[model samples]
Target: MGIKVVKRHGSSFKDKLYLPAIAGGMKTTLKHFIKNLKDVDNLKTMQYPEVQPDDLNERYRGVHRLTKWEDESEKCVACYMCATACPAECIFIEAEERFDEKAEKRPKEFKIDLLECVFCGYCVEACPCDAIRMDTGIFSFTGDKREDFVLDKKALMKNERSKDLDND
Candidate 1:
């Protein structure tokens, strides 16, 4: 390998001060501030807790939820595809033979460690059955303990939309 020596350029008086960059940043801040002052809607600030955002994009993926069939039975067949495909390795499933003749297997114990989940939607994509989805629109999940953050089969099933659960 041939060595090539690169000449170093000395900083100019303006470059040394960094005033131009600072001024440009401040100018942008002031411009946004003034614009926000006039139009509250334009402001990036949100009154969270009191007012949840309703403007999430159509394709926004949030917390994971387990879907159920029309009969309220679980849609998940306990297939290990989701757990295998998850890069974060957060999904855990224990399969048991279903009593129903139609379905061969069901998740006897399904657990997802929210603390470890990256919310990449890999699990949803890997599942052969459309049994898992990230459409809860719930990104602000909070827990006091690690165990509280971990969702079991029942908890995941509970997160399904009200309409889906309704027999009527």
Candidate 2:
């Protein structure tokens, strides 16, 4: 066994002066400025808030939501699969026995701390009942209080289906 050591070369006089780096940066800025000037309409800048970009990706996992069946009942069976799968441990669920014989259990309380969530979509993938999904198409969220970021079952249920998933 042998350890190989390689000699490192020092920067040349021109590189030390950084003139070429500055010139390259200026050239790039000038090229972009001229290109934008030639086609002002092609500028990517949007007048945000009033004019939102229309290029939202269909697969973007924006927000979490609980699915509802045709009768408007929650599809979750309180299996805790999603909570267990969450690497961030942001999902919290309290299971209770269901009155219906067909459904053995239901979530008495379900909450997800959006601030702690990594938005990795593992919860959605772990859901066996297709009860949880992250396709609300609402990537932006703002709040003054920490509690505002905590989404309860009601809030999760209110999210509309993503445009792409709505067709399904």
Candidate 3:
């Protein structure tokens, strides 16, 4: 096939003039302004910081956390699936021999570098045991130094310490 340059009419009266384009744009703006002016109380804009929004959806992936059993023991079997599946390679785990009857191995040292994490949730999906989750609903996190963001087993577990998890 060959490329063809076909001659066509340059511009119509409406296309040549800038007034119609400007008026069309202004109509949308004016409509929204009028609607907002009338429905001032029903605006979607939240006065953040003072009023915390509770609009996070069910599937919203926030921060990572290590889940625990009813007895407050860690559910992770130290299988290294989460670390293996992490695209950022932020998850680090050290396995140790567990004397408990529930599992043979447990994580001696579990760490996740939040700064390096991409929040892809691959680690949560890869775990055979329902150990790791990203349902803390805490997207806002801060750190003064590089080391501050590196969360260990204690920190990950602490994410679920005070907050009540949604059973659903």
Q: Point to the candidate with the largest TM-score.
A: 2
Models 1 onward score TM values of: 0.77, 0.82, 0.71
Q: Write the per-residue lDDT of candidate 2 for residues 62-152, one digit (tens) a residue.
A: 8899998887878999999999999999999999998864489889999999999999999999999999998888878889999999999
Clashing pairs in 1: none
Which one wins on lDDT? 2
Error of 1 at 32 (Å): 3.5
Indicate the residue-level lDDT of 67 in model 1.
92
Clashing pairs in 3: none
Q: How many pairs of residues in model 3 come into backbone collision?
A: 0
Candidate 2 local Cα displacement, residue 45, angstroms: 3.2
The reply for model 2, stretches above 4 Å from the true place, is: 1-7, 163-165
User: Which lDDT tens digits does candidate 1 get at residues 53-159?
Assistant: 77765466777889988788999999899999999999999999999855899999999999999999999899999899887778799988899999999999999
Worst 10 residues of 2 by lDDT: 159-168
Cα misplacement distance, residue 144 of candidate 2 (Å)? 1.5
